[model samples]
Target chain A: MLEKAIKGSKLYWGWIGLLLLGVATGFFAYTFQMKEGLSITGMSRDVSWGFYIAQFTFLVGVAASAVMMVIPKYLHHYQTFGRVLILGEFLAVAAVSMCLLFIVVDLGQPQRMLNVLLHPTPRSILFWDMIVLNGYLFLNILIGWVTLQAERKGVEPPKWIKPFIYLSIPWAVSIHTVTAFLYCGLPGRGFWLTAILAPRFLASAFASGPAFLILLCYIVKIFAKWDPGKEAIQSLAKIVTYAIITNLFFLSLEIFTVGYSQIPSHLLHFKYLFFGLEGHATYAPWMWVSVVAGLLAVLILLFPQNRKSDNVLAMACVLVFLSTWIDKGMGMISGGFVPNPLEEVVEYIPTKLELLITLGVYAAGFLILTILYKVAVGVKKEVDA
Target chain B: MRANRRKFLKIAGLATLGWSVFPNLLRASEGGEGAGHVRWGLAIDTKKLNDEVMEKAIVACHKNHNVPHIPDKREIKWLWKTTFHKAFPGQMLDNMHISEYAEKETLVLCNHCDNPPCVRVCPTKATFKRADGITMMDFHRCIGCRYCMAACPFGARSFNFYDPKKFLKSEEITTQFPTRTKGVVEKCLLCYERLDEGKKPYCVEAAEGVIYFGNLNDPESEIRKVLAERYAIKRKPELGTFPSVYYLI
Candidate 1:
């Protein structure tokens, strides 16, 4: 099965070459950053974290999206997701790998990551996040490998695999929830110290992850000639519709609390994100784009006729992915840092080096995603024939 | 009081663990809370902090610690000057023209909060509260995540973004205190080495009556006496971080 990837068309090799180029560029930039230290990046003391951490936050949600398919198939007994389930699980594995890489690139001391394990401070949310993220990755791989082997052999998956599959449902939610706790519990960061952040993270992850999966399935249908099924794509679109609505609702709840209370510390970050703080409105355009894309996705996804059409469905999913990508990748993490601890607004803009490293991580994820999808599609194509 | 017992147990636990497992590890991790028997604190009289004394005190403190003089983009400061309004934005008075302390330049450093959010958020135990309540940073252990910097409410913590050694004039760099590396969070450690040697803090010695230093847990100490006599105020008192620094306004 692994050898199947070696035999590919010119287009496949070209895609791999493009991703390889991104990885090499990122690696070159990272070596310089390692020697010169984090100063090479645009992050300052005031806005401490930059592109790496923001992308990490967004990818964690994408990793958690695997449970969207898991819940529908195992819990709800939805047959439509049976063929699509492996794709979501593989995405989780690749997404989690990217999340881990982003963290490494973000570190001022990446070499000292083992300190979390050695020291093992349970009180710290970062310590717990490490545990859950790795645990989620482990569970997904075990479930995916064993189940795929059983499918190939035309036999039932072992009884032992069932319990792990069940356990993964909650484990998926925990990864993103724990990640949110990393931001939420800090006392001074008023933008992040909200109760709704974890719920909001889960809602957005469910929408965006499956929305991307919808597009991926279409790509597979066109390129690999693997039509997962029309019903499968439609069912996932419905999930995206409800998930985005809930994500929007959780965001409004946050807005209401911040707006009604009118506390300067609490409301200042929202002002910075949406309207720009102290005339640094660089993030405002991106945030407003998210708002419009999100609203448009919801409208398109809601109507029965629009959602059923392949063209509208494709457009809706792209908008949904972009909407959440900006919300989580651009706004969620940095928004917390806008007004630094002293209530001074210090906006962060990513340097070219930072963007290069980020792109490198995304390319690595795509590489993992490409290989895994190729294997899954090959296995499915053989079984069907 | 509860935190005292908790920190003591943690130290004891870590001490025993270090003895059994990581004796070499403890040697590198020496910047623990200073003079651990009592809660160390300060009470500063703003009226006494004249321009000459403040400048002398700041210089002494920075010189003793090898605190680098870097550019604005990559600044690394332990003690510095800020305006009264900037230091205490929440406590600003409407009629600044009438208030004596309104326009005064405030001496600022790490608040060394009783409930340090930095210690709580650090992935590694690189930064932790010692039993005496002085928040300590083991630069050896700091992964430079800057989570501690973000968690600090007073904007006290600074990261060594660039190589500080690059900017320091060789003659000016002190040999006594080790300069921090390029990628680690550092802050006012309340002069951990000086406190260990039974010497008064450099700033406290230079300022004379302006800066008062003593054990807060000891009721008979001068800082406690100042707090009892003067209406001293800590920055952002309502936040419940229980900052050890107090100002005799």
Candidate 2:
């Protein structure tokens, strides 16, 4: 598996090199942040969490979305999704690893991070988030590797792995739900106080996770000269279609509840995100882009004709991915902070240092994705040969 | 795929059962530090809390705790004065006439809730409530996640974004309360250091009969005495934090 990534086309090697460069740059910025404390980033007392935490939230959904493929294949006995399940599992392994990194970098005292484990408080949602995320990562790595080894050997995967696979389905849902509790359980932050938050997180996760997988299959097809089969892609597109539509539907529910009730504390974040709050409408434009992208993604996927065409389907998948990224990664966390506890409106704009660090994290995730996909493809190609 | 649905069901059920049961085992381990003491609380008489009196009290607390006077963007506070409109938004107004309270500011500090949300949400037991109903922060254990800052409804907590001593006078870093390092949350500990020495809180000592601190559990204590006689209110009482502090408006 490692050897497969070692041998690659010039483009593949170039991409890996670029990602390494990104990781190095981000590591440098991280050192500066560590030296000076969080003041080096754009965060303040009001906006305590910024780019790092938002990315952590978004990637947790992406990590959880690995189940969309797993559920259809293992539960419903969909043969098409079985071919692509390896891809989803690997994507999750990468996403969860990235999610962990985001948590590490976001800490004010990285050295003291072990304190969470040293003094575990299960009452704290964060304690549970740690438990579930690491558990999911280990589960995916074990299942994905064992199953692939069995495929290479032309034998059925071991019986022990089957129970773990079934366990992962619920485990996936728990990872995102526990992450939602991190925000929803907090008493004062009105923007995240809704009962729908966990469901909304799952809905958006189901959309973005599978949507990224659809794009990834094509990337595998083009670069590695391996096709997961059109049936697999089409099946994934359908999953993304429903998830995106349901995600948008959930967003509308939030809009209705927050807008109609007109409670200033509850309404303020939405207004600040969609409109402006006391002249600080920095995120309004980005929030609107996400809105339009979400609606357009839903419309494109609903049509069976567009769903069949690779170009339109790819476009729709990208649209869903982008919009979900902005909605969760940018707007949701920032919105919760604006009109902070004191009813004071303060906007968060990520510093270059923060953005560079974030870019480094994404690059690292991709590097893992590339290698994992390479290994999966190598094993499949060897089996065919 | 030769999958037995029943076998899968058993495995899935057991795994789910394991996850649900494990956290409770850990949660049951959590308990307050140093049991068996009366709960401490504050009773503030707003009638005696003028702008000058509040300023004097704030300065005294800062001097005692070595709180930094940082720039507004990076400001940190433990005890401060805010207008009644800001502190008690959408409360006690419409039918009731606007008394002198509408214009005058109210003194505020950590409510040190009987159920502090900050303590509940902190990933580490860095922030925990003492058995005496005092909320305590162990700066050494804090990872600076700032979840406590978000969980606290009163805006009582502050993060040391910069080392607090940077803005403090050289002499202000006193032996009374240890200066907190950067990247840890800090707030009024109800002068826990002074309480240990049997001395009154700096704010209580500075005020003349305006600030009262005593055991809430003891009916004979000053805070309980004030609560018995005066019409008092705690900030956001409807939220049910059970704030140990009270205000006699």
Candidate 3:
């Protein structure tokens, strides 16, 4: 069985084919980015950030979702996540990889990314962001590799792996928290200037992250005949429901505080985001769509009957993920700069080159995640024996 | 006693080393780089800042800088015209709102603040304040973060949504400064480059006698002469961003 698994795995060729296609597309996009600079993407002065940042924000939530599985398996002694643990780790690896790519593509000079570390600015939040992102990426890699190695051996896992697993629980939270701080720490952007942004970020992250995981589990069950358990999905759905509620509650608090105060500066960005203030209605439609989608997603997750349906549950996760992405990533960052201190509305739209680069990065991340998961699945067959 | 003397010497030596390590700390608590150098401040005289002068100054500055006025109203503005009263929304002239001259506006641009908010918010240290109270951006280092835009209450920053240099007149085009790609923000630099050559700012030179061009620090400068003899005011002193541009009414 081990020899056959190594010689001709069912999923291995499919993974390799997809990976090659992704790499080719990514290379083409990268070449375009090099020639044209960042003008290819949509980003303007008033809306300095756009889709890439939104994607980064969304991926952080995905990365943090690893803790959903890790916490249950290790701390609560929930055996339901035993098979699903590798899936969570693989998702984290893909998500973090995407997060880094988004940031690189967003930069004006991608080569100068090293300067953030080499010429470290202790005063800048970006310096801390660099530290946290790289740290989180490495932590996930170490944990995933060690856990998988132990799982394959079928031993109770080494004692050292225990500490790393425990460490990952908090580290997962730290990644999203650090990402939140990146926006909240900025001074005058009224929408992002709240003390509750970190909590809100974590809440939303846990919600969408777990939703994606549950959906992924169901997907693999149908396609690969891998049944982690129905109990795990039900348990994860409950956690996700609560997380979504918290996310919405926090968002409401932000809106209420800003709206009730009637402060012009504080109200400006939100007004620009949700409802058009004057002629600047660019992101207003997207903002409203995200809000409506988010509310609907929560409702769907809240109902057990709807969550039981594989199609509805999967679709809810997809919508929830996208809605959160638009809200946290796109609107949040872009809206922060609108009605800029000078009261001028500078519009930022990402360029075509930027879009290509972004697509390339996504391909790279997906390719990595796919290959890693295939290897894990192949190795799982050996361990089960 | 010998031990005490050695300890005292050691303490003194450390103090000297500390001062040497932070060289700037050795300087007196002067507002600017050079001690006794008067910090420049602006006082706008709303009466003289009419639409004609505003247009003239803006056109001159734009022409000189090759700032493109993309016909799209939203995209237009290098040195645009804005109402003087609206510009200084916080302060009132003689306790009465300056509403009568609402139709006639003033030219507004970057206010080279003594403590600029834009400089404080820059993540990459791209936007910085010079020793002479000039807030400038190093376009090369700018990562298009737009934090400076959010921080600036003045709405002075602009992002290069496309290659802006492409809009330049054929003869006006130069490769001295890389045309900002889409993403990075750019704004008025107060023509610091032109100032280095002992030339008045393009706006001031083009304004003929409408706008004064001289150092505010030197009391003997034309700007100081105008302020000493005439009634002048700044846009928003209440914001605590001490601007270096003044207007004479």
Candidate 4:
């Protein structure tokens, strides 16, 4: 066992040590937040949501993006996807785990989380959010485990797993769409009060999430000496390019509506988010950066020459991922509350506890991804690919 | 100690679910134990709002209820004022130009909507509508999601940012209720506890009849009579929230 462990030295102990460090730091940070309340974080009344939730929202899309591999490999009988399908499933486990962790840290009282279960309100979008999040997590775990068991036994996957794999395609859409609904269904916050938000969420998720997975494929090639095939990478790049175009289109639709209507309440929110309304310029820089990065990513992916280059493709993927991470994950929710209910501009900065806890959560995700990918790589090496 | 702890837990648990599920059940179970049957509602005469009596009513309710005035102005609001035009955009007064009085009148607390959007959006069922048509927020169960604040159309909710006691005077602190911690949203409950004590709302009593407290359900009630007799209006009536609170123009 020790020899086996030594053989995969980079994947085993190094990954474990990183996870332990993250868990330890997160424990301390969570304890502090619990002792001092949410005030220990940078969130205020106007900006109630921040980094943790943004990360949660972004990661859910990444988790759902696993469907890209599952759909093609199983449904379409794409032989190319067979070699790397495990990577997507494992990445999903990591992403979903982090999504849950973000929600926990974002809660004012993490201990009382069961209150959601004890007193469920069907009328509330939040109640459904909990349901969808948990359901998605369980679905991924079940499918991933069943498929892996088949791989281990050198037998065909179970009959039931096919239905579930099929169900998860639309279910994957629902998880992120429901998340967008949690914001869009709100009555007064004009920032998210639109019919288009759900579609927008799916578009951006497809853009950034597949980009992340493709990057993971490249990373595996570099570190683990496994190639996910250039064809798969190119196909993913095509999906991302189209998704980015749609994502940008929806954002433009929002801008046009706000500008055309010229309603003070609606426009003020967009103004504050994009260009700094009434001297509230904190998020303005981030918004502009997101715009530039997003546009550049789309252009890079669309241009065959750019997408063909590994470095350029990797850079484009990183930029698009972060842009959506900022735009939808952080800025969308937070910007709604600025020029608050009372029309006053208030700033939100995450506290040290929040920052540390967020770092720990990211570390936890990295640890999971690293370990899972190792197992997947090892399993694949044994196969006659 | 164990028994007391158990009892407290039971009560707290029941209270948490009660307001969300069956608020009216308590009134029926408790056998209407007040000064006769009362379906409480408030009537504000904005013209009289500037009167010292009305201001005293606001202050009286604030003091009796231990409502904190956290000096960080953005976070501070239990009772305050706003122009009619500012509060309701589309509604037009008959004599807009000549009557400068309409501009100066102080708009008090939430209208206490019969169909509250705040209650609809709360994830933990922390803010629920009482059977008596009062929208009350339970600070203990609130997860500080702020979805309630986002859902409220009237902009009545205020979140406590810093510890409220830091900004309040010692005398301002009352034993009847605990001051809120940072995070959870809070707003006026229309002195429901005071109404339970066989007394008019502190606001009404202090206002010396400037603020009328009565059963809006009963046609013979003071508020109903006032609504019928005077030209009265509710804020943002178009939204169809059907607020029990009425203001005499």
Report the error of model 2 at residue B77, Å: 1.0
Residues B1-249 of candidate 4: C-alpha lDDT, one tens digit per residue: 999999999999988897779877775677754423445688887667775765686688677766676544345566666666556543534465535644565656777887778888888889988766778889888877667777876778777655567667887688887777755778888777876676776778887777788887789987889888898877666556777778787
| Off by more than 4 A, model 2 | B1-35, B92-96, B99-103
Candidate 3, residues B153-175, lDDT tens digits: the string is 56677776556655667677544
Global lDDT scores for all candidate models: 0.87, 0.88, 0.73, 0.77
CA deviation > 4 Å runs, candidate 3: A1-23, A26-33, A161-164, A279-285, A303-312, A339-356, B1-38, B63-78, B83-96, B101-104, B161-165, B173-185, B194-200, B208-249
- Docking quality tier of model 1: medium
> How should the candidates be ordered by DockQ, best one leading?
1, 2, 4, 3
Cα RMSD for predicted model 3: 6.9
At residue A164, give the lDDT of candidate 2. Answer: 99
Clashes of 1: 0
What C-alpha lDDT does candidate 1 achieve relative to the native structure? 0.87
lDDT, candidate 1, residue A203?
A: 98
How would the candidate models be sorted by TM-score, starting from the highest?
Answer: 1, 2, 4, 3
- Which candidate's TM-score is highest? 1
lDDT of 2 at B57: 93
Worst 10 residues of 4 chain A by lDDT: A1-10
For A195-271, candidate 1 gives per-residue lDDT tens digits of 89999999999999999999999999999898999999999999999999999889899999999998777898999
Better of 2 and 4 by TM-score: 2
Of the true interface contacts, the fraction found in model 4 is 0.47
